[model samples]
Target chain A: MTLNWKSGGVLLGVVFFLAVALVKPIGVSTQFVIFDGILWNAINPDVVTTTADGFTSPNAYLAKSGGKYAEAVANPINYSFIFVLAMMVGAALSVLARGGLSREERAMPELWRSTIGGSSLKRYAVAFVGGFIVLYGARLAGGCTSGHMMSGMMQTALSGYIFSAGAFAAAVPVAMFMYKEV
Target chain B: MTSIILAIVIGAAFGATLDRVGATNPSLIGRMLNLTNLHLMKTILLAIGVGSILMFGGQMIGLVDVGHMSVKAAYIGVFIGGLLLGGGWAMSGYCPGTGVCAAASGRKDALFFIAGGLFGAAAYMGTYPAWKASGMLDDIAGGKVTLGTVPGASYEGLTAISGDLLGLAIGAVFVLVAFVLPDTASRSGGQVQPAE
Candidate 1:
């Protein structure tokens, strides 16, 4: 798809503003909710067990009232998660509208292919491993890149700056390695 | 009903912007990493600037509630976690949210990223006992501490004092960098861009 900086900039700004004003601020932690719901049912079925008449478990109630589990579940409903979900939907619609939804040729940089190995499966493995690492970091840090950088910075939180700096410091070198062949 | 509908619409808009800006592409993100194209940086900075001004201003005018906002504190675990995440981003080219976005847009690799993230989260949960036993969770400190909390101050007082300083610093740096950097087309790479 054709891309231009000016339009891109304006669009990002508009969406970001609307996100904060209408939906919620940008963040990636909401995905954790979907994850939590899945986990709660799987790990401690008693915690999430539903009664025949549709009452949730007492443990689920207590867990939701206070604890790390509660915190995790709460995040999914926050504005940040909604905003991120909106972003995904928006992105898909745009591609479809532009007739750019067709499968394009897979482009691989030589260095990346060599280092990560040249199969889509290998690349996916890398993506999965990488995603896990980043999310784990997000949980530990109390937020993801968008929450820390975009939302946190807007509030002038010091942690936001630290998170952004740390993310970039790690991103640059790896980016160089990943894109060297390109 | 309104919030949910607003959510879907807004989410669509956000996703559209990422796609249009080529942010959905790992190569574009990688380019931002290499400092060749700063579109992502610019977009990010501009978003921060605009959002900050709006939020801060809203707070000042009683349109927003600053006190109700949630903020995480500084902790050693966060530092270590950030480091690991940064390294992963550099290595894999995707983050959590963007990974979902990319996958939704039909990028195969992003699906893997999502799976991996699920597994990693589960692993962390499974190992919680060992992690806590290791004292990793002990004595962690920090909770909603802002500049206003640091000293004798009112919310308005702190906002006035810090806002000017941060605005000036961030604005100046953004202008300087934008002026200095030349736009380059996105790089072509095999990796799918992760959500940030």
Candidate 2:
């Protein structure tokens, strides 16, 4: 009776159905790639990836519409980006409605303090650093938890299963190593 | 136009789901990762397990396009990347999907973690050339193969078992394991049932 288990499963089913009704299976990792596009457009507009005739590279699905700087900026605003933005909005609403917005009673401050050492800056830094490393790998590997694990598994793709196995195989040991002090 | 609208609807549901399940709560995730609390595992496994069944089953009835499913190309890099992603998940207590929702739900710390993700993603994108040149990203074993191998299977010959059927069977196990795992209540404010 601790956590509400049924809601998440039901919601995922809903998401899958709606997503199928609208776009392809929903995934969030593409948002990261879009973020990369936005950053690149901001930094160096000329440094764009494209096919021979300057069309958006087919592999670069986000910018499939193809344009110059506008496309670069617009590239990040695809389905995945919208999904991510909505994710924040949805989460915000949930928190507000659920009445658990207190920063004072945040979850797992102790585990974080003990595992990564007690420093807000350190925690933020570790999260960012870890995020960066993880994203790098995720992008290289072609997906993240949602895109690879959830979406792929649903489709019964080997890549999905393989990634899941590899993730747990690595995650358990990493968790063990990181929390060794505890 | 239409895409954004769909995204909004999808995102809200997905995000709310994350919140309801305690998936947005980093502390809850941390406990799950610690292998101490097992409540979240059931939720996660159940979600994936059931998801697989529905997705494939839907395709069977033409409710979903088996072709539209986006499968990542399998390569050695995938496993290597998985390890990195897993390490990051353990360290940050947030995956890209959960992190964004967590941040939006008022987890300020998740924002930082997400910032890290952005930077991490940027690093990878910036070095895309080197990664591709490394040959690790090359598809191995004819990437995007399905788990099943029945005639007319989505991916033919990867295995004798049908991919969707296998997924359904495995997903059932996940649901079983989630229920069977010992439940321990979280010590954190966000604590849930731990195990029996």
Q: Residue-wise lDDT of candidate 1 within B1-196, one digit each (tens)?
A: 6776777777777677777777667766766886656766676665566555555555556565544354555555555666777877766666776667777777777777777777766555555456546654443334343433312213232233565346435544543554455555345543433434
Candidate 2 lDDT tens digits, A4-68:
66566656655765675467777776577676667766677554555665535323334333633
Interface RMSD of each: 3.3, 2.5
Every candidate's lDDT:
0.60, 0.71
* Two-chain DockQ for each candidate model: 0.47, 0.56
Best of the candidates, lDDT: 2
Model 2 segments beyond 4 Å from truth?
A49-54, A57-73, A105-110, A114-118, A179-182, B149-157, B185-196
Candidate 2 chain A lowest-lDDT run of ten: A55-64
Cα lDDT tens digits for candidate 1, A1-182: 53555555556655655666554566675465446555675676555443343334344322432344444343456444565667777766777787744443133323356445677767767777887887777766667766776666665665666677777877777776666543
Score candidate 2 by lDDT.
0.71
Query: Candidate 2, which CAPRI tier?
Result: medium
Highest-TM-score candidate: 2
Q: Write the per-residue lDDT of candidate 2 for residues B29-138, one digit (tens) a residue.
A: 77777676766776777777677677666766767666666566789888888888888888878888888887776666777878888788767755766777889878
Give the chain B TM-score for each candidate: 0.72, 0.85
Q: Candidate 1: where is the Cα deviation over 4 Å?
A: A1-3, A39-44, A49-85, A101-117, B62-68, B128-142, B146-176, B184-196
